[model samples]
Target: MSALLAEDLLNQMIPPLKSTDTTAKAARWLEEFHVGQLPVVTGTHYQGLITENDLADYENPDTQLAELPLRYADTYVQHDQHFFRIMELAIQNRIQLVPVLDEQQEYAGVVTVSDALAAFGPVPGPAGQGSILVLTMEERDYSLSQISRYVEENNAKILSAHVVADEHDPFRIRLTLRLNTDNLARITATLERFGYLVSAQFSGTAAVSEDEQDRFDALLRYLSV
Candidate 1:
């Protein structure tokens, strides 16, 4: 359940410029790269980043790229930052392309809005095609999808999955998967063999034991806790 990092999502080696570069060159880079902004740097150190809106003042378009006031990342992040924070910056600023920097303040890459959306958007959970094995797993474990694929390949169908960060440890996640349970026993065995921390059952005869009374008791306990 290791989530993608901002640096991994960022597009750091973006179109860049030296302070002395001309505005025309900047505009050209913007158009050529099909980007609205370009990060301006000096050597490996980040000097500033500039956008077309910042350049709109210069109708001439011939101004020196160096002369235009360069803007920097208002909420820029280091290269090793979390992806969720990067999403917050893009949504708050209403801009694309989040710049990433190294410890030396040097340009690393850029994280585009598209990448963040792709990574953070609703993704299919385990038991993708058939019945799901809803449970909790250590965040460091990366076999969630693998386990789901195995279930699906064996003729089960995964309905849906919900994942929540563990309250006790952020590094663990509680996953609830809904899967078609035609062969419930086999599915459970497969999941257990694959190292899934099986905590509950949710289908057919096995589900009968977990009726409304049980659900109510569980809810009460949860609320009291």
Candidate 2:
């Protein structure tokens, strides 16, 4: 499958500001666009990202962006970088927007967390015709090949897989897998037979519950802010 790169999700419509632009101008753009952050550039070169909070302490709206404390000046990914990289940077920095740069280190555009997730779609969800199986195990015992083999034995294929570290237990991990079939009884049984703990199962044939939809919306709102 082709990788979803940064350039593919770039929001060219979201304009960048010049360093000479006043804080007032940046703030206006933020309000107008309903975004918390905006990228500041010098000619084609990216300076850094500026947030509304960054300008809150500044009494003078006319202060030049060059004089203000711009953040994440070096926090940018290449245009060709995978979208996952963009997501990592956004989450790690707790920022809503990530800047993309060209090979010459010039500003390309910015990617909003909302846009990134929208492009990512519902991978391990009911949006696609597949079943979701969540498994929890010791980090050391996790192996994709082994898991795949168990599923394949039941004549099932994994459509997508995601791994997340357990927050309370660092040595444990949670694995969420999307299978190509709605019926997960056989695959679940096979995995448990091999000592893999299946924590939750969602059938593709079932409609996504209202509660789950609410949670998704809440998560997206939190990330966007």
Candidate 3:
């Protein structure tokens, strides 16, 4: 697949407003499109993002957007930048729309968080059989090369891997992997043997075995009672 760039995800259909536009018009567009923010530009040069809050703070519908406070004048990503940077900027600034700029620093378009999520929501994996494995470890222990080596030793290939910091513990991270095999028993054993904590595993046979064991334990407790 081709690289997922910011430009590819651009919502060019969402028309940008000029600084000369009235706050009432901007607010009407925000309400109609169900977006919290909109890009304000002068010709091709992006001025900044005008948000609903900005309009509410101004409290004057007749006022021009130029007179109001437009935020993130420098908070835009290039058209060729990876989509991840767009997500980062959206999260950091707590904004819904992220402006995209071309190589010449002219406004290209805007990308919405909803659009980004839709583009990246799919689990990256091969078209064939596979299993998912979730592992939790310290941030310092994350080594993709080492983990790939272990998976390879077990005769399994990793189709895709995603890492995210654990919200409960900032020092730890969660690694989710999709392997190119249905059975994960051997791979799980190998990872555990090497001190990798397999927090969760998704496989047909393993799930059945776990369910049976839980049922057996429950039966034993009932009989004793």
Candidate 4:
């Protein structure tokens, strides 16, 4: 799938909070799902996001979500938006999940940050040992020769490159680059200086502790289902 959209990565298992939902139920859902926040909606119309901190002060566990102040009411993406848009919303709002909207700007579902990063990180290729970087730019602005020259200037080589047309914008494209080095600090900086958007990235050379490795292995096993 060249173009992976936000709708494709939606985690439907996480339900939205309605106006009548109480603070108690919201707290329980947050803890149950291990998420810091959840989207609050009134039918198809998305209201905002409710977080754990928003519920801590309310003395009444029965207080309705509609009664509390919500943040990031307008933070959401459309069904046709790319997964990169989901990551942008999540990072800009610092929320665990991003709410999704439909063609009419009505609530469709929610996309978790983890799911978005997971789907956006990897590119299909033979197993290699470098980092993966994703770039989004206008199709007219793309010049593989110029980009390849830039990477070469940094003393690195591009192992593989994958280009995908943006689903929402025909004039735009997404480029996934598998570099021969895990140290992307310089290449990314150089690309940014030249006006390239380094969106989602996967750095493969970080040291992983025993516990972290075990957790990752467990997650892989779970995803295999």
Candidate 5:
């Protein structure tokens, strides 16, 4: 599946009104859209966003929406930004909607979690863009240290490293490394010298080998199951 773009996910027509808007109107919009948060805009510029929590303190359902506290997002993505990045932003902030802006900072639209989720499919994204390396070693191995040492020694950084027991063989552990480097042969050679057996390397590289594809599939199945 392909990644979604902020522009593709943007709900430009669903812009939220200013704080000066009546609480009743805002509530109605929330109900109509079924969104917990709405992006507020003034003319063509973005002002802030209003969330459902801000409505809690209001005793009157008839209260002025503008009177509700505004919760703003410090990070807003331009319309040109990738949808995957938008999803990350939403998850990090625990918000559902992200306001999209043009290069001129004009309010272009909004990226909602629902739209993004639908576009991108299942997430807490499972082994999508980065590289994955499968290093085979003994159960007594301090896998992380070995991988870190080799990665750093190679002038590339390790984004993440993990160790999982070889399901079919408990005595062996599969050390997975998400790294900055894509050179499989070079990485494998370095680790092999340190007594680590590199089973496979998976990455976002255009040309994925058969073994890499199998490992990628294995990762997805593991994550889902």
Candidate 6:
């Protein structure tokens, strides 16, 4: 029932290595655990992260981590931080795994990018079933309360809504909403009559008409470009 936290994704399978550990051992563990990096710790105090690329510079395989110049030492999330923050930091730092710290600022564990993504993939779940509607309007005209009022006026409730800037026009925004009703004819009509552009519509399920599928495929290609 609770949202996932940074500590929830902590992967103990990839254990932390000590500063006195050899580069040979770190490299071996990275390969064994199928990870790009490993945490170097001095008991509860996190020393920093030692990555595969970082070890490549070492001429000797027996070199200790304490003698190595570590990167992403400060790149870590607090245990209580949101799961989204973990992904943000991972992408920002270009690392495959993120470190988590406890209340005492001690190394709690690490969260893999894959684990965080898997946990996020099914979000806004079944609550946002039925129909999905998209509207394109100027950023200044966007109002959640006004839109909710319109949906409620049609005897429907918006399950979830998200806003993104129009790719072609930064001044305009694309609002996507998941409603509780599949029959969106009345809602769409009322919105269009009130000067709102109903850009797209989709049923709750993945099944779509051939024509719609073609358009959806084209849209995916365009976004990828």
Quality of model 5 by C-alpha lDDT: 0.66
Q: Give the C-alpha miss distance for residue 192 in model 4, angstroms.
A: 10
Estimate the TM-score of every prediction: 0.52, 0.61, 0.58, 0.68, 0.52, 0.57
Compose the digit string of candidate 3's lDDT tens values, residues 93-206: 768779999989999999887776566444344333466577879989989899999999989898667676654688987786767676788898988988888986655445
lDDT of 4 by residue, 1-225 (tens): 345677787898999999899999999999999999999989889999999889998989999999998988989888877665665566556677888898899899898877865664543343434666789899999988899999999998886665777775889888877677767788888999999999766554445566544433333232222
User: Which residue pairs clash in candidate 3?
Assistant: none
lDDT of 2 by residue, 1-225 (tens): 334577888987799989999989999999998888899998998888989889898989899999988989989988867555676677567787899998888899998888877665555433434655778899999999999998898888887676766545889877867577767778878888888898766564444687544433344343333
Q: Model 5: runs farther than 4 Å from truth?
A: 1-3, 60-67, 122-225
Worst window of 10 by summed lDDT in candidate 5 = 216-225
Total residue pair clashes for candidate 1: 19
Candidate 4 stretches with Cα past 4 Å from truth are 122-154, 157-169, 176-225
Question: By lDDT, who's the top model here?
Answer: 4
lDDT of 2 at 177: 71
- Report the alpha-carbon TM-score of model 5 versus the true structure: 0.52
Q: How many Å off is the CA of 15 in candidate 6?
A: 0.4
lDDT scores of the candidates, listed in order? 0.62, 0.76, 0.76, 0.77, 0.66, 0.76
Residue 156's lDDT in candidate 2: 84
Clashes of each: 19, 0, 0, 0, 4, 0
lDDT of 6 by residue, 65-160 (tens): 999988888999888675545655765566789999999999999998777656544334344346657898998998989999999999999866
Whole-structure CA lDDT of model 2? 0.76
Top model number, TM-score: 4
Point out the higher-scoring one by lDDT: 2 or 4: 4
TM-score ranking, high to low: 4, 2, 3, 6, 1, 5
Clashes by residue pair, model 4: none
